[model samples]
Target chain A: MFSEWELKRYKRQMMLFGDDGQERLKKAHIFIAGAGGLGSPISIYLAVAGVGTITIVDMDVVDQTNLNRQILHFDRDVGKKKTASAEEKLQALNPDITVNAIDVKIDESNAVKLVGKADGIVDAMDNYPTRYLLNDVAIAKEIPLFHGGIRGFYGQATTIIPGITPCLKCIFPKAPPKEVFPVVGVTPGIIGTIQANEVIKYLTGCGELLTNRLFIWDGMQAHAEELCVERNPACEACRGITTKTPARTKK
Target chain B: MTVKIRFFARFRELLGTDIVTEVVPGTMFTSLITTTARKNPAGYAAIFDEKGAFHEFVILMKNGKRIELTDAAKTPVVDGDEIAVFPPVAGG
Candidate 1:
């Protein structure tokens, strides 16, 4: 049941997916794990795409350094909490969709609760520990995890469908050493948009998901390729855990 | 025999990629990467530790199948093999 305004708002995209697909977007809820570089574009795109609800969690204040890539925040938002900045911008972007910007650290203690009732989880996080936590939750809930990471001119993204695909732990058994990594704004811009694209594709059932494959983007070389990845039967994070896909059409 | 080695991410920046070189029929996987990586000292250092062994975190694949770091030395490279070596990037 779309309002006249809602139908008008999604006219262009609705052409691709039709009214039923648009209805799915209007009924879906997505949880984004960061409000920084990657999160900025992901949430912004999803909001405008009319994902019915978006829960974005971040605990840091917008730093001046973040403005280069964290597009959700502006120079004036430097000292403000990222959640506050993100909420204001997202709500303004699509008043039709609901946005819940939470200010909290997504730790093991609260990761599950923070992500409650979402259709999918987007890993816009900068670090692997939290990404792993989100992976665990995705496996537990049988939700898809849209994973992306960026550094300098390199980024990698993969969609994990819990029991059906290789979990993040299966792909990268170890996390790289942390650094004050160098990055240009376009790096996350490229990667985050791919993640958002994956989300839209997943929700609309329009195309093949990035499952069982790692999409590697090398902006320096302008090369995009995918490497075949498989589930590790002995994966520490999801070994022996079988999951049933959530009934996406149950509504 | 000839084999092609592909390095990715930081390793690619240091060693360059899609390296095709001739090797003896019985060359092992570890030696093939070592010989190709040794052309540049920094590249060698990035792929291997001070002990001349692959870094623990480096991922190695042979013809798209994962080759364990411990087994690299025992794994022999076949003719026309494609080996991929990469280091995962850990930033946002």
Candidate 2:
């Protein structure tokens, strides 16, 4: 329970979401798969908001290149494990919250167990295999997931309400065949913050999350675009799930 | 027969604007990528780099459905098919 002062600190949001939102935030448990660029903002924001629990899974060690974007790690924290360093600082950010730091690459073997333990999963991974891995696991487990991606000056964000909103596999039946790509730091900041916002909105039941719509940012010209995405019956992730029949997208 | 090709996210940047309507069949999704870019290099330079391959971030969809890379050409297209072109998305 947040103290009176603590409650006052979050007054603006509390006034918006009311006590119900606060309770939901305290009841939610989220798994953040990548603690690099995207993971940094999501993990920190969720923690500060007092999400009941946050489990971060990552295996990469910090490189100097991370400094520009990974605000969670400092120059002195360089060479340290990203999950560990992030956990230490995130806990310090909100000691009242719980933070689980798993220092390992999330793969087929562990994705199931991790995602199954959460109410929602946030895709913060770096590559296609892992992103696909997360998509597969989330859809299989029927968990809501918020997805975001940022590269160079471009970024996109969407939420998959499992069986309801279209899964990544529906939008992208297969990986893009490209492993390494270019990215800018702030782009992740922009996209990750939106993801974090989705979590809060969903938890508080305040407003509509970005479902079935791909929100995009184009940095070259610095403009925004939104395109409708649809749930595909042929999607291996959602096909024959037999749960949320006649899935609908919120305009 | 005109197939509408739409671009989203990074793909739009590489190829300015979000859409293009061409009087080409759907089966030519792969063929048109290279040919169209060659015809309008400035409209698609970042889409395919020096190697003359997709720049890694781009994805192609036909009528709202993804065009599997393996069966990209055989993905089938019809008149008035709306093809979606996207770049790999990464936030979370």
Candidate 3:
């Protein structure tokens, strides 16, 4: 059920994943949790890729200092709500897809409600408390959590399928002490793209997901590697969950 | 015996990676890292607390398996082992 314009808009990418795959993208809804550095690229890419609906939430106003890596905002957007700028840019990028940008801080009280019914949750957040909140919601909702983090020249990403892979709590167990972490735009650009790639693959049912492995990127060394990750049998957040059918296999 | 220690992210920045070092046969995981990380005071501080215990957030793995922070003190490193220590990169 694609319009003539929709078909033409998605022509090049459709070559890779025929009409059936295009339909999946057209029917999916992805929830991205930030509108800052990682969220900028993640939402833009997903929007253009024809994901039918994108729900991006952020509470901060764009500051002059954000222009370096938060590409969704511009000098003109300084002092504008990040959600407002994100919605405008994402909608402009793909008029065919729906973009719902919400202005609110994501906390345990609202995380689940905010994510309501989305096919997947993209962790574009900058801190661990909210990331852990999103992780709990992902486990509770039994959806996939596409996790990405960046600091300076280092970044890491992993795809967590609720019952099938190690949950975030299982992997880190403890949160790192908070600090004003240093970063460069390319760091989030790389990690965010990896996360967006994971989302596209998850939606369209192509390629092996980043399941059971942590992809670590060291931009300083121009190297990328993955370490095997396993589910902790005693993980407090997802311990009771059991693998039934792999999410990818469910596709 | 010989073992390879790989430090990642900030740890890697402070202490280089893929460090091949010699250790006594009975060396424990904690001591091996303590000795290697000692080469750089900042690196040691980043991974350990004032009391020299591993920071709770530091993840340690041997041959692709996770080693709990508490168990690292008693876990022995055998010949040809590959150890990885890193902090979760926390940013967007």
* Best candidate (score: TM-score): 3
Which sections of candidate 2 miss by over 4 Å? A244-251, B1-14, B18-34, B40-58, B61-83, B90-92
lDDT to native, each model = 0.90, 0.76, 0.95
DockQ-wise, the better of 1 and 3 is 3
lDDT of 1 by residue, B1-92 (tens): 88999998888888989999999988999999999999999999988999998887788889888888899999999999999999877777
Quote each prediction's TM-score.
Answer: 0.96, 0.83, 0.98
Give me the chain B TM-score of candidate 2. Answer: 0.67
Off by over 4 Å in 3: A249-251
Best model per lDDT: 3
Model 2 TM-score relative to the real fold: 0.83
Report the lDDT tens digits of candidate 2 across residue range A231-250.
Answer: 87777678866554422212
Pairs of colliding residues, candidate 3: none
lDDT of 3 by residue, A156-237 (tens): 9999999889999999889999988899999999999999999999999988899999999999989999999999999999
Q: What is the TM-score of chain B in candidate 1?
A: 0.97
| Pairs with backbone N, CA or C atoms under 3 Å apart (clashes), candidate 1 | none
For the record, the alpha-carbon RMSD of candidate 3 to the native fold, in angstroms, is 0.9
Q: Sort every candidate by TM-score, greatest first.
A: 3, 1, 2
Rank candidates, DockQ, best first.
Answer: 3, 1, 2
